[model samples]
Target: MSAVRGLEHVVTRLSDSCGQGHSGSLLEAPSADVLSCSMQAVVYYGVPGDITDVLPRIGEAGIAVWGPQDGEGRDMPHARGTVSYALTYHRDHGRYPDGSLMSTPVLEAAGMRVDWDRPGMPMPSRFEGFVHSCDPDGGHPVYERCSTAPKEPMSMAAARDQYGTVLTFSLGEPGSSAYQYFTVPRRQ
Candidate 1:
């Protein structure tokens, strides 16, 4: 809407740079070109769900950073199968099997950056995102509201069946630590 269109893409320039120096120092004066190119926003719809506990269970589910693993099943740092962050969601309600709730859903909807779960999977995600509640609430009229779950290779259901209520997450630069949102739990 015309109302929200007024504000958008607000970012400040960076003044520092990383470099090796002869003075035994790190981050020399930023090269003209280096400082010239501003840092592209590093944010997207980061679905940060909870893992009933936050450790072990998630350990079993490998993120396989770039893609699948090698024959030995070790993630090659420079290879496609490196390790990425593993996420889990839950409800503070009950347990599973008999289907009880666990933790909580922190984002409206989330997904992997790419779909590597398919046959002959193509290049991973170029960019992945979900609409912040503000985005849907007309935060920016020019921005389209992304109200949906992420796609294949990045889906939680296919990965691990976990769900919760009050999905919450941050908004922007000074974006808050956590904002709760919503989701359907498989608990009965």
Candidate 2:
């Protein structure tokens, strides 16, 4: 089967298994936070044989995969001789602010400043641009930066106090357009 077809098959099997609520099922429904926080679906699967032929097909499908070693650097358990992989698919919603895109020049032309020296900010070279909407109360534009590097973590309170309402952050994935987008509400 084609890569896309293969992925569809995997998704179908997983969906069926989860819907059945079978004990010891490999996949489970995502949490509420995972649903709200991002526009992506991740599926984990294990195979009882070498994936040498499957890897190329997965690459052609442009799906991000993580396997063998998990987040904690431990080898994924896959019986006596098997491989496990996590496939990530990012869903495209639409453009921000009425489908009109913004560039770096446009933001600068509008008198909005790019704060580069903020702690945990990505380097200038990795900066892509910004997507912003005006704060109606004061006609100030709230900006969100897109970058190719991950920013250091900061508390929500600290970020709001420092950047006002919107916090500048990075989503670093080499050669991928999955930019991280976050918005913090104004402090009450």
Candidate 3:
């Protein structure tokens, strides 16, 4: 599947004009104040995972932008959801399904900023991620160190290669074209 691209925006601050705090499902409170705040950090609402593919220096920077859609589902001028919050969620509290927190060093390398430790802010209960491999289908190759079935969600444990090189992780669906198109660059 070809990637569905959207415009990229750099959020520098979160606006609180609506007088709401970052608690509750971003999906439910469509009118949360966090949505209109400065783009500096992950505010409210979760977006589609494809933004990670276009964001700069990911795993080292910040969340990808998942632009908003119109009534007909066309890309709107503004973004509705963010992977930044999810990245911040992983940075502050996300644990694997087995109870282990992610330990990827590159995720904290710093290019994007997320105020993940707000004292009383609430976050999403679950997050989806995509793992990349050399295979165009994002599948784990037979006899290879790390692998996943094409388009199927895999555990972080299953995504890590024997060499300890993690491909790429995203909040998008594993089978998404944006996820599959993401390739882990070699060290060279």
Q: Pick the candidate with the highest TM-score.
A: 2
All candidates: TM-score: 0.18, 0.21, 0.19
Tens-place lDDT digits, model 1, residues 133-186: 212221112222233322222332322222221111113212212111211222
Off by over 4 Å in 1: 1-59, 62-68, 84-111, 114-188
lDDT of 1 at 41: 20
> What value does the lDDT take at residue 36 in candidate 2?
12
Ranking of predictions according to lDDT: 3, 1, 2
Give the TM-score ranking, best first.
Answer: 2, 3, 1
Tens digits of lDDT, candidate 3, 27-123 = 7633222221111112112122332343323322324323344586433432223334344434455455567654322222222322121123322
| Candidate 2 TM-score to native | 0.21
Model 1 lDDT on a 0 to 1 scale: 0.24
Position 177, candidate 3: lDDT: 38
Clashes of 1: 19
Q: How much lDDT does each candidate structure score?
A: 0.24, 0.24, 0.29
Off by over 4 Å in 2: 1-40, 46-49, 63-182
